[model samples]
Target: MESGQGLGELIPPLADSDYYLDHYDDLSCIITQGLSGKIIVNGQPYEEEMLALNNISLAELSNLINYMNSQWYPDKIEVNLNTIKAQLANCAD
Candidate 1:
């Protein structure tokens, strides 16, 4: 099922802001026990999206937080948006 119209057709690219580094640094410092993070999507604060992402069993949520924490890298300016899929793999089965 690899009918490639190119990946841009499936997922539009997001814009990058010059000030994004501040937020990226902020995210790396968040407390995993009760993460209170928000990411903007299409120019709006996306708490709903964040909530949906963490919607899972408690163990999985903890594991997901751990996975995210482990993945913080200052050198990687481009977010692997698909990395969420990789992090989910670390969640409790």
Candidate 2:
């Protein structure tokens, strides 16, 4: 996958059982996928903490990418950061 691709585009699809089998040991993946409604592992329902963690991960990833791009390509990075900040603010409400 390209570095510019979004998380949604980068994530691969997998069956619920298969996802559990592959990622049960990886708490980050399990929480992320579960919060995104992509997979249900071990019959466990998605919880607030999982969703929050997913959101934090996404936010951090976005910020990191934006920062990197900002150092290399200022204009595009500012635009992307503004857009992401707006989206995050909206999500807060």
Candidate 3:
């Protein structure tokens, strides 16, 4: 989690509500199809290119997303298989 700490380039903190809240909806797409270019999280800019996890099956990806939401975001949001599927279907790959 502690990569640079207010110094240089940073990995968007998934545990921070500010970051998660803004990108949660598109998180699934980002995870599945990968993300490039620049993204602002909590006003800080990150230009990291996340590699797509397309090698995994839908069920595994769903489980990972669900686990992350439950752990990091708690009851704020929930991602089911259908939701992941829909997100993947709409992903620009």
The numbered model that scores best in lDDT is 3
Q: Residue-pair clashes per candidate, as listed?
A: 0, 0, 0
RMSD to native, candidate 2 = 12.0
Better of 2 and 3 by TM-score: 3
Tell me the lDDT of candidate 1. 0.36
lDDT of 2 at 42: 42
Per-candidate RMSD vs. true structure?
A: 11.0, 12.0, 3.1
Model 3 off-target regions past 4 Å?
2-8
Give the lowest summed-lDDT range of ten residues in model 2: 4-13
Residue 45 local lDDT, model 1 = 47
Q: What is the C-alpha RMSD, rounded to one decimal, of candidate 3?
A: 3.1
Minimum summed lDDT over a 10-residue window in model 1 is located at 4-13
lDDT tens digits, residue span 1-93, model 1 = 133111332321122322233443333222222233554433444332222333355455445444443453325534343443444444433
* Candidate numbers, best TM-score first, in rank order: 3, 1, 2
Candidates 1 and 2, the one with greater lDDT = 2
The lDDT values for all models are 0.36, 0.41, 0.71
For model 1, what is the alpha-carbon lDDT of residue 51? 21
> Per-residue lDDT of 1-93 in model 3, one digit per residue for the tens?
433133356566666547667766676777777888998877888988878876888788878777777767677666678887787777666
**Worst 10-residue stretch by lDDT in candidate 3?**
1-10
